[model samples]
Target: MCPSKVAEGGQRGWIVPIGGAEDKENDKRVLRRFLELCGGDGAEIAVIPTASRLNETGDRYEQIFGGMGARNVHVLDFDTRRDAHERNRVARIEQASGIFITGGNQLRLSTILGGTPVAQAIRACNAHGIPVGGTSAGAGILSEHMIAGGDSETETPRANGVRLAPGLGLTNRVVIDQHFRQRDRLGRLLAALAYNPFAIGLGVDEDTAAFIGPDNVVEVEGSGAVTVVDADGLQFSSMAQVDGDSPVCMLGVQLHILTAGASYNLVTRKASAGELSTVKE
Candidate 1:
């Protein structure tokens, strides 16, 4: 895993593929990792399940996180933001040492928090190394160029994924997508990279996560894996043909699959470049 240079005393973050509730084992492990990143007990943590299966999402989080040893887990119901609701949510983000986002429809998170006080608060918390993390949808929004949300089964370049209006640009020049293999999203990610070649593409698998540090190191953990598609140095054809909802032939692109015990360097935007556990593609 590509573990960043740990600060003397700072919180770390884990980007999971959809929050850890679905997988009991993964949830436990992620919770342990969160605890570790928070430096163990007394870590002020909050869980925002803003992205969930619509109805019954918030209460589900209390049940899951409460069982994970999180004593004071604050749930932010962004669906209907009252004045006091916004203030409390922003306050929690500002004071939080660790903020965890739940998995569901990322669009839900973006629509509510986009250009809002809470979005800024979330970004501020991440900037200070407060360890902002999420699974599935949460993981997808970490990149400056977020995938937002997209459709599947359509491999054409015409497929357009929503942008995070005002995403927390922790990692810039990159767009992230989750449920990679399980969902067959490589073509879509490639389409996104084709449209913006300068940006990187990361397709994370279920039950897997990428632990990133301030130093730009990303380590792969859990039973699943992460795919890194770097088109920055690729030799490709015109994106116009593909933009017409047609398939475009991509000539050269660097793709790497980083699984458990593997790591990647975000600064270099390459995998297996450091001493961390990693594999060359």
Candidate 2:
């Protein structure tokens, strides 16, 4: 296992990846959890709504977080890549206790924030143990390699069904898919794993979340489940071996379905059985 990234004398910040459509008005369990990890009523949060084109997207989260008792909340909005690269624009992120990214379009989030100073600042803050949370498209960009967009309802794994793109690179070895069961995204996520078998595939259902610790211990929370697809031991027909839009043939893939309170260790690739149980990879 890798050593914890928590700074000396400080608690390790969390990575909260939420599937879209979380209830902000009712229980607000997901957002509440984020606030708790971010330091409760004293939390300083940065809200990035760049994924959504709507003018009010950022405001909506600002209001939500404010009502949740965040001491300070700032919305970082950038109209262009030039604005995204401005150090002044992203300076607030460096001082924040946590950052929340809203849902809309993953491509917009990546194209605007990728390789920019703001993205760098986020990576730096996360390294220093600042919790970062995102929902829907926001959740998709938490990994180094992200599923940009895909055909959700496909029954088979098509070679070109899913689109891949560069993301925030917060987590190094997993690909995230949001609104998993709600949208029937299993096939799409499976296709992504087929293309990048070395990484674990996480399909998070709507209203659910996976809180990843600095040591890569992921604890599922909220109403739905998280589906973990491990393709490490899989035998598959190569993408190059097939022509046109044929389904990829795969074997020996391991799948685990986890609900709230269940945890998984990214380092050992094992699921915990109440007390950190170990499973064969």
Q: What is the C-alpha RMSD of each candidate to the true structure, in Å?
A: 4.9, 4.2
Error of 1 at 225 (Å): 0.9
For residue 155, model 1's alpha carbon misses the true position, in angstroms, by 6.2
lDDT of 2 at 3: 24
lDDT of 2 at 55: 95
**Candidate 2: which pairs clash?**
none
Range of the 10 consecutive residues with the lowest summed lDDT in candidate 1: 13-22
TM-score of each: 0.82, 0.91
Give all candidates' CA lDDT scores.
0.66, 0.85
List the pairs of residues colliding in candidate 1. 1-262, 2-219, 2-263, 17-136, 18-135, 18-136, 19-135, 262-277
